[model samples]
Target: MPTIVVDVMPKAELLDPQGKAVAGALTRLGHEGFAAVRIGKRFELTVDAADEATLATVRQIAAEILSNSVIEDVVGIEVVE
Candidate 1:
């Protein structure tokens, strides 16, 4: 089986209030040295094939459904055997 991994993250120019809140909580909990935090999404899909055609389709799906291109980006894609 092949597993497709996709990571979606907010664009640098976009505001991530959730991320900021998490960062603030971390700081309140005494965690330090981190400059900032940005929340994102990851999807792990097990598929029959990890070929280029499948990847292309997945990319299109990501672009269309998984991310808001105006404020987010599909940051990573990988196929794991």
Candidate 2:
């Protein structure tokens, strides 16, 4: 079996309150290495096979189901063993 990983991120123009909160916490904890942080989502889907047809279907699922088109973008989709 193979696992498909889908990465989704909020649109660049939108504000990510969760990310901001994390960044603030990092700063307060003396972690100055990170200038900013943007939170995103990752979905792992297990499949029997990693074929072209399956990949296409996964892409469609990533775009239409896993993420909101208005606020989030499907950044990446990859197959992992």
Candidate 3:
């Protein structure tokens, strides 16, 4: 079996309210030295097969249903086990 990692988040063009809120809280917490912060979502998946075809299908699933490409960006993906 192949394991997949999926991360999705708002694009640079859009506004990230959650991230902003966290950043504000950090400042109140006395954690300075930061200007901007962005938040994103992460998903871990286990695939039946570890092949290019299967991976492509997974990618499609991510693009169509898993994540909204228009307002999000995939920061990274890692296959574990």
Candidate 4:
């Protein structure tokens, strides 16, 4: 099986309320560790396709249906061999 990893993050221009709220709470929790922390969503994809072409198709599907290009970016794609 081939696994594809997907990540979605808020754009730099857009405001992230959830991230900001978490930052606020973290700061208040006495963990003033990092100056800033950006949070995003991650996923692991499982596919039975065994060819590169099919894998490409799956990637495209994930990009089109699983992600939004404007505000979020795909941060990683790791293929386990």
Candidate 5:
């Protein structure tokens, strides 16, 4: 089986409270080199085959369920070993 990966992240203009909170915590914990953090979601789905058609279907699924177009962007989709 192969895994299809979907990465979802908030748009650059949108505010990410969770990411901001994490960044603040990182600074407090003495990892202060980072200026900002934007948390994102990755979804993995295993399929019987890794083909172009399967990839297309996974793209549709990610667009419909894995990400919110209003605020989040579907960065990319990949087939992982």
Candidate 6:
């Protein structure tokens, strides 16, 4: 089986409260080397094959179903071993 990985992230302009909270926690825990943190989503899809057609469909699915176009962007789509 092959796996398709989809990475989705909120638009840079939008504020991510969850990410903010995590960043705050990191700072409190003495991790000051990091300036900020932004959380995103990763979707792993298992398939029989990783052909071009399947990849196209996965791209569509990532844009339409896996993420919110209004606020998030499909950052990446790739086949994994």
**What digit string (tens of lDDT, one per residue) describes model 5 on residues 1-81?**
899888999999999999999999999999968999999999889999999999989889888888889999999898899
lDDT of 4 by residue, 1-81 (tens): 777677767776788888888888989998977576678887777768547886677678667877788777766656665
**Candidate 2: worst 10 consecutive residues by lDDT?**
28-37
| Per-residue lDDT of 71 in model 6 | 100
List the candidates' TM-scores in order.
0.93, 0.96, 0.86, 0.79, 0.95, 0.97
Residue pairs of candidate 2 with colliding backbone atoms: none
Write candidate 2's Cα lDDT for 9-65 as tens digits.
Answer: 999999999999999999999989898799999999999899999999999999999
Backbone collisions counted per model: 0, 0, 0, 0, 0, 0
The lDDT, on a scale of 0 to 1, for candidate 5 is 0.92
- Stretches of model 2 off by over 4 angstroms after superposition: none
lDDT of 4 at 51: 74
lDDT tens digits by residue: candidate 3, 21-61: 99999999999898989998888888887678877877887
lDDT for model 3, on a 0 to 1 scale?
Answer: 0.84
After TM-score superposition, what is the CA distance of residue 67 in candidate 5 from its true location, in Å? 0.8
Per-candidate alpha-carbon RMSD to the true structure: 0.9, 0.7, 1.4, 1.9, 0.8, 0.6
lDDT of each: 0.93, 0.96, 0.84, 0.74, 0.92, 0.95
To one decimal, what is the Cα RMSD in angstroms of model 5 from the true structure?
0.8
Candidate 1 local Cα displacement, residue 61, angstroms? 0.9
Cα deviation at 70, candidate 3, in Å, is 2.6
Model 6 misplaced stretches (Cα beyond 4 Å) = none
lDDT of 1 by residue, 14-72 (tens): 88999999999999999999889999999998999998999999999889998989999
TM-score of model 3 vs. true structure: 0.86
Q: Least lDDT summed over 10 consecutive residues: which range in candidate 5?
A: 59-68
Give residue 66's error in model 4 in angstroms: 1.1
User: What TM-score, to 2 decimals, does candidate 6 have?
Assistant: 0.97
Model 1 regions more than 4 Å off: none
Tell me the tens digit of each residue's lDDT in model 6 across 1-81: 999999999999999999999999999998888778899999999999999999999999998999999999999998999
